[model samples]
Target: MSNEDFLENEDNLFVQKRVPHDDLHELVKYGDHPIYQGLKDDQSKAWIKKSLFEKLDYQTKLNCVKEEAMVIALERYLIPMISENQETSYNLALIRICTTLTKGWFRQFAIDNYPQLINLDKDLLSIARNVIEKFPIKRKKPVLLTHDPETRVIFDSIRPYTEILSFFDKLEYDPDDFDITGIKITSPVNGNISVTAIITTLCKYNFSCNPSASWSASVIILPSKEMEIFLRNYKSSKYELISDLTTKYIFSLRIKANTSGTSWGVGEDIWKPIYVEAKSADDVASILEIPGLTGDLLFKYVLDFLNPTLARNGETPLKHWVNELKSEGAIPIKPEQHLWYHAWNYELKSLFM
Candidate 1:
């Protein structure tokens, strides 16, 4: 049987009801156990019973329990089972747990957040990667997601009616193709784990807001052929689009003038992108002087316009710009846009770096 079929049936072996108080205690029992102490030993598996597995599996489905708790429960189970042996039963159980837990939001969440936990064991990493590979790839209808209050505030602040075209991975759409109204943000992957985490977190957040139908749908737009090879062969590269062919971490957002998709506020050539390096404060000056831009009036307008999409990538453009400028020179202008630019210009600027 297929992995899905196996998981679907195995799920029945676990209880499908609310986790009882006793079960929660059982979960905590395993949680307190030092599962991480040993490697490749059957003794580790001795503590985790079938009942505990059922409890962990059942609680994973509940919204009340935080994802970290489920992950802890998973690690607790994994440490023991994987430590014991690579027997068929152990391997199959790992696959089932990986596949079931890494579905929907949890799939992207794991990829975006937990690299260390995944790579902690070679066998464990294989299971996680396999789960990612087998995820259903198809065009899902655009549906609104329920975000927590803080995230909701961030979502609400974003100005509506904008068209963003993201070309990081290719599924049904080609990278050169521009007859679309989506947003593309590429991860500035430089092989450093922390930097990559920042890049992926931003990309995932953007994807969360406007996820494509499949992994292939996010086209990786390559700036050069060399970087493409580096990324594809990088071993831990998560973006399925980077194969020996394409790559780039470009972000573009355009304001839609009306309900009809035809009219654009920036320019008719929406396909042509103006790449801006987030690291350079000088780049913002050049953008301000772009021909057809009304300068002063459009300064805040442009920043506000890009705010929604950029916010997804874990850095606010204006906030970053304002903070960067304070270090360079005296603040200019008193308007709220300029004020926002000036006030935080002197604040701590270490986070994004």
Candidate 2:
């Protein structure tokens, strides 16, 4: 049977579930058993159980419980029943548990946050590489993701929206083929973002409002018949068109508008995104509303009006960037975890590097 079918088969003997509280009476009857001492630096059984209870995240906690359950189940039942030679189903369940746990762990890992992993030991790095291999993703047909870790994880869980998403794992979209649409802010927006304009597909597609769909706010109506494609993708699916490819770490994007014309704003001294000057969301929507903007000298109205200080280049995958450090034999010191880890999920800002 396939992996999914086997996992669903209730007729199979062993699956990872909680060992009954009543079942633990058997362990206590053994009285200070050596088998129980093997947990977490030989801590007392109570301490071991407490540690598992304290774990956060659905999968991590489940993994801990499954591990403890397996140990007890093997010692109490499987080993004793060895003479019966009916270990195949039990062994399969245990193996599946480990495999499932590992994939879950990999999904949760964010390589960019841990700068220390730039130089992993050969043994550990091999396993890390293998886990990444299990999910092969191509960067082309990129989806916009949030910089916020909490929101990013939520986005990651609902990924591959294949109905709405255009995924090309190996082949890439041509950068030359993709340019900003002609629609740009008509009037001076100044610094207020809520006034920024947007079109169909998303209403709360603002950085100030819904951070998850903010990418739509920026690149409204990707030009060409592609707009029809995007609109069709948007209209027909319940799934959101955008997705976060990486769980918590993705490469950044940097582009200074390759300008067509130059227009001086009312107060041009301040430097911010052209979207900041938007009078309304539709004004922001107008930035790329129409199709076919070959910046060539159409009117010279669309200026390369970007802050010179902004990073000119876009982002690279953390894996690609991190490997360079490994090649250079760098081993960074571990950084402290955030004190308020989930606090930034509500922050309002464009997700730049």
Candidate 3:
């Protein structure tokens, strides 16, 4: 096709062919449509440019060329006819267009620029909220924010409450608190003996523990007093370690590795250490189900540990052992037997086994 024909064809693709003014489409197709040719003509370019500046000044109160260009492009080309007013259909079309164009940024910008639009018609806010909740944005994690009634007001007002809550949710604590001072046991330590040491340490330090929580690779520290009492109450000889509670609080500690090194060499090497709670031997066994640990072993561990307690009217500590076993490792399973996966799986198996 000729260059003019090609440009016309491309422009036609952008402008809908079937509209109320079908004659306009035919007129444009024949290169005789006044509006179509006017829009396409070099002479009309000046008017188009002027129109954009006018709209930008009217809409945003600014007249910068780059800013005006985007507004002009959207007004003349993208916005549907139905979105020209504040009526129900207009609001809906506006939301649809904003969603199509801006995705996640729509809500924040809409709230900033069009607070009256949301306040005058709550349905628009609701629609926008629903759309934003489902749309994923490029950020640290999948967006989990939901649209509640209260959030509707927050969005309309650009309030600080929601922003403050969002800030706290993303906060990460300093790594030093749990890592450096917490218990550290090297491999080859007797399981039962290690358990005893852990419990004794906790009890002596007064660290409170909950035996029911799953034993996982988490870094949280227990209070010192609760840690001490736990150690005094735990006793088991056969297992690798008889943690008073299966779940332990761990903290990431930074250790200095090299004295003569520069930069991070003399800096801290970080490691997470866990504080464990004691559970029934059966619970412990079920928790320890290290991939190869059979169902029988799982059952035996629960039964043996809880049997004496059960005989003495104590409660069975194990809950949903197999499911816990199945969910033991990191999700979105690793692609290779790398160090991180190996370490993660090893830690998981060790905790449960």
Against the unseen true structure, what C-alpha lDDT does each candidate score? 0.28, 0.25, 0.27
- TM-score leader: 1
User: In model 3, how large is the Cα lDDT of residue 23?
Assistant: 28
Please give the range of 10 consecutive residues that has the lowest summed lDDT in model 2: 259-268
Error of 3 at 312 (Å): 42
Error of 3 at 77 (Å): 31
Residues 236-303 of candidate 1 have per-residue lDDT tens digits of 43434333222332222221111111111101111111123212132322332323322222223323
Regions more than 4 Å wrong, model 1: 1-32, 37-69, 72-275, 278-293, 303-306, 311-313, 316-353
Which candidate should be chosen as best, given lDDT against the real structure? 1
RMSD, candidate 1, Å: 20.6
Q: Kindly give the stretch of ten consecutive residues in candidate 1 with the minimal lDDT sum.
A: 257-266
Tens digits of per-residue lDDT for model 3, 1-353:
11121122111211222221222223123224323223323531222233433333323321121122222222233232324332444344335333432233323344345533332322333333332354323233322223345434423332221111122122232221211112321112233221111211111111111011112222222332454565455555312222323345221111111111111111121112322232223333233223333332322222222221111101111111222333685332323222222233344546676
TM-score for predicted model 2 compared with the true structure? 0.20
When summed lDDT is taken over every stretch of 10 residues in candidate 3, the lowest stretch is 203-212
